[model samples]
Target chain A: MRRGFPVWAVYALGFVPAVVAFGGGLAGTTGPDPIRALEQTLGLWALRFLLAALCVTPLRRFFGVNLLRYRRALGLLCFYYASLHLLAFIGLDHSFDWAEITREILKRPYAFIGMACLLLLIPLAATSSNAMIKRLGAKNWTRLHRLVYPAALLAAAHFIFAVKSWPLEPLLYAGAAVALLAARLAPKRRPSLEQPHEA
Target chain B: MLIRVGTDLPIASSEITPRSLWLRRRDFLGAGAALGLGLTGVARAASPYSTDEKPNSRADITGYNNFYEFGTDKSDPAAKAGRLKTKPWTLRIDGLVDKPADYALEDFLKPFSTEERIYRMRCVEGWSMVIPWLGFPLAEAIKRAQPQASARYVAFETLVRPEEMPGQRSFPRIIPWPYREGLRLDEAMHPLTILATGLYGEPLPNQNGAPLRLVVPWKYGFKGIKSIVRMTLVAEQPKTSWNMIAPDEYGFFANVNPEVDHPRWSQATERRIGEGGLFAKRRPTLMFNGYESVASLYSGMDLRANF
Candidate 1:
């Protein structure tokens, strides 16, 4: 039990806020205007946490920080919160109006951005399983997961435009995503393995 | 007595109060208060403006707000405002005024008679709401303040603190703190403009600018700053939040004229809150939010540039 402290604690800590949000949502505590602001906040946080998770892999591989097992859990958590955010829109915000939903997806620019992000995640989540990864092969799986880069960008746009004013927060997230992507694309000098006999 | 279409008011200038005319038309229904009110309603039902009401575009006056001083979330004011100690509140009046005086919230509030006026509140975001605000004309308050001639503009300030407001805890400033707003002397004295202390017949929720907040009927909602901590009669233009952040997008006027669109989106249409029907219908947004009664005050100025 004591040995499980760190892992369980991380999971527990993350669950606290999500559980509070869920309870608050269920209790109808947010007065009349809850769904739009709540969904945007949760989606933004999920995207932020996902970016943090994505950074873990790069940090471990490039900077040699092997203590990165938490990334997988955090990534799954982001997907969990993001799924809730999508559910809130369809269930609460739109009340599952099929015709209205269709029109919104067609007419609203931000709606398309949100839809694209959620759609991209479905495949990513399906491929998250170790069994599905083995079936796809490691090389193919990595390429598929690269969709997260665009997904994050789309999610940020979904939030920025969702607001009537103050795009600073969304702009900051966009900047961070661009910087991370740039770092990943930066050319690295691979050390030649076969070296002549050194003195 | 011309009741012309596209005019600020439907009735002639002789009949200033539509409510009074409406009451007379309802006399046939009999004189009891409830029945009289219902009769007035029947008259409203028969009016051409009934269809133009664009009822669906109304916001839940309770929710359509962003008073960040109390908290960051839009709903925070409504939720966390119960904690605000409004009773025994005192307002200190000073600076460029003939009389520098301090008054308690209740004593100062008692003399002003309240009227319920439904005004369209347009957020810079494109969505809008029609709120039934219980307020008195701001001109009444300014008249009492009796500012000196040097006082050319009215400036308002919101209480500030990083600890109480989570938005302030962040590194990058998302919005200007002590959220300031201003109005030119003539604009501040517009007949339709109000100084609101309550809504839905109750003291305003702290998020909605409890104690006192200005409601410029013709301007975008943010111009109605909340949690007002101070009011000063100043000589120059005050630094407003949106203007300081992006001057190109937010002008000093920030009027609700559909003609002057925000750079990012069209203001020609709006979604009225609380009126359900997802993607209900689009109605032509009124210039100056149907407050042309006050628009002439800005006749010589360029609205496009001032917007």
Candidate 2:
């Protein structure tokens, strides 16, 4: 029931997983392969945040819940996690062997899909600032942000492919992503009497 | 608990390995009570090659497994392999051998004495674990058969009971059922190759191959076929399950060589399970999983080509 959810709160919550992963790593509690576990955790959070960012529009349209202020924070957090996921693969797994990393990106479908999703997110992250948003004009900025939909789908694909077998957790994330995207396609209904009309 | 050792005490090199120390901590504590009596040294000196790396925790080892018969998910084997009937198992040794026979699991193991071997298990997926296995050398079993001179390869096969193995019953089976693996005759006869029947000083868990399994220390884990039902000495290189399914990805000689990368990923480094944190750096993979003794087996052959 809290209105105007603070953007700083979203950011603080966003970093909780990172802190837990770091603490667990230091304590040697992450289990036999901490690097792989950390990589998976980061990638999963990236997908969750991306899906959460996509949920904002549908939530406002259908449920009359306004979380527009925190949408940028969620999107940025998604990008942050995505970056860490890639870093874990390249730095920890590959040991900065650029040749091997490039080979993996080209040869592995999951890696290619993940890299593509991150690449698409880079422009969105760059244009997130108010100054760039104003410079690009409202219509172009809105159009550019639409890329989030495809990026989310790519991320879901990456998650599915990354696992040796298709597990339920990744499938559930993919299903949620599809449902959110489908909700955007639904026809907008007339404003309810209880809801305030946007000027 | 801490034990002060005198300078004159002759400690086995294996006792110093991180994995041996960590895994034998309980035993070590008990032995610490009688440290000056040299009882602990006698017990520790028995192992042939115990690496310095610590074996993964029992929880990690038992909880995470890759027995595809139960299912493909790492946890699935632990959850479902309990259904397997390991007691009434029989192993068949035949083909190009002086004696072709089927022996009950217990009867087959009666002739040989089991020894504890701590080895590094490197999965083709680029994850690795140090395990202490209880079994006798594969050479002993092969010697019993008296393989013919013409025999050039050894083929291994796992049980294919879809009724018990849910993964085999899965529609659109992932890998071919009745999983198969093979090794060159020389590789099979090597002292490092073992037919493990127990692990961690206990009867092997159902998920960890139950009654019997192969433990080829220097090869990728898949080469160490589990839940084995048949082993045949053949005149030609036998077709292996992984090699048949994805010939390009998995080759006949699936040695743990960092130089040859899997089609999907690099094998230069591997995540050592139960060690570093989630964000911890991966350890660089060692050739033949650090078993330099087996290097002579592949002399003059291109590992990358074989891979």
Candidate 3:
């Protein structure tokens, strides 16, 4: 109970958005262009998860909100949604046309950055388990997981270019990502004795 | 009047639309103020250029749109466009035209005879729809204005009421507001270029550009600027809203060319809305959006470069 909400509930809440996005999409409730709508909705959820996971640190630092136990769950959810976003693009948007998909990935900077972001996440997501962390040692695992910062940045870039215009929603998401990351640069006190972080 | 079948508005059921079909559509209008319109009850002629293809459902047509003045998302307009009051609207036509006046919306639409024109609309975002637009040719108004020889281009502008249009008030400006679009004089005078007042045999839904919108079938859908407030005939080519925003991605001409891809997305194929559900293959896009009769307009020019 001291840990607040259970980690499994974090996962359950995550699946709710996935179900709503893909389920609403497949059922044609999202509108006429359900494939594109679903693709974007999944991508939006991924960004939200990445931002939420990144928030765990700042909330602990400033607001004294300890959501550390669920950080792994949030990060893993980001990976799941990111993969779904790509699946929608490939399976629905491009229909598994490897040649066309490859050409688009090479040609558009957004596609290139989006693919690169998912590739970068693969290693972090793979190593998220406690057993893998134990094998890699705490110091190395922390360093490797730091890849999330760049992943967040790349995810924001992919969203901006994909939108094609600098609309407020994408820009607001981008601003939040940058601000959450920049919060790390703020002067800090010594880490709490209960939850020691990377030195 | 140099009126002949311009292109691709193929002679599909040129006779009057059946009264029973109009009665069937009456149930579909759903509280829209179309019944009050004088254009109602007058049997509209089927366009010689009208397409035989089934038009998209009114729900799909209105529910999904890109009236950036309302918002950026496809569904944003449908949700937010209710704030716009289509009543007491004014249209200002000036610049190199014989008659330059700020005419009321009704007076502006008074002269032309209305008909139903079905056009295949292709979006720059790689989606397409077949829309049955109820309006008259823009050429009819252009002829009435009697453009001077200096009028090489015709520019149009959308209304910019920030109170009604939430998008106009957005900080950092998603698009430079009072969205503007233009067409070459010949393109404007072409019989296919229509000033659409309504669609689906009812008043145009606010989301789908209520009151007034342009329909240049040969060009991309963005060129069909909505809720038009101004028309200017100028000597030099005008700056369009999208072209002004991103010069490389959106060019001035913006003709529907499968060969000329957008900087981010392929234009070679487009998913037709309401055709097939989620897993269906996208249909191949056509040059000039399959309106081949207008090809002569760009005979010597390069579409790829103009794109």
Best to worst by DockQ, what's the order? 3, 2, 1
Positional deviation of B212 in candidate 2, in angstroms? 1.0
lDDT comparison, 1 vs 2, better candidate: 2
Q: Who wins the lDDT comparison?
A: 3
Model 2, stretches more than 4 Å misplaced? A1-19, A52-74, A90-113, A129-132, A165-199, B1-54, B148-150, B162-166, B169-172
DockQ, per-model, please?
A: 0.14, 0.32, 0.69
- RMSD in angstroms, all models? 10.3, 7.2, 6.9
Encode model 2's per-residue lDDT on B1-307: one tens digit a residue: 2211111224422345554454665476457656665565545454666565667677777877888788777788989998898767889999999998998776787788777788899999888888878788899999999999999999999999988899888754667778999999899889889988777766788898877899998999999899999999999899998888778888999999998888767788887877645444577899999999999999999998998
Summarize candidate 1's per-residue lDDT along A66-177 as a digit string, tens digits: 4466766676777877888877666656567676567667657777788888788778877887898899999999899888888878877887766645535677887887
Quote the positional error of residue A100 for candidate 1 in Å.
Answer: 15
Q: Give the Å error, residue B129, model 1.
A: 2.2
Checking candidate 2 for backbone clashes, the offending pairs are A32-B273, A32-B274, A34-B277, A34-B278, A35-B278, B19-B54
User: What TM-score, over all chains together, does every model reach?
Assistant: 0.64, 0.78, 0.89
All candidates' lDDT scores? 0.68, 0.83, 0.86
Candidate 2 lDDT (Cα, whole model)? 0.83
lDDT of 2 by residue, A36-137 (tens): 767888898999999999999988887777788889999999999999989988887667889878988998888999999999999999999999999999
Interface RMSD, Å, model 1:
5.7
> Per-residue CA lDDT of candidate 3, range B5-85, in tens?
211232323234553575344344333335555443444335788887778888889989998888788889999999899
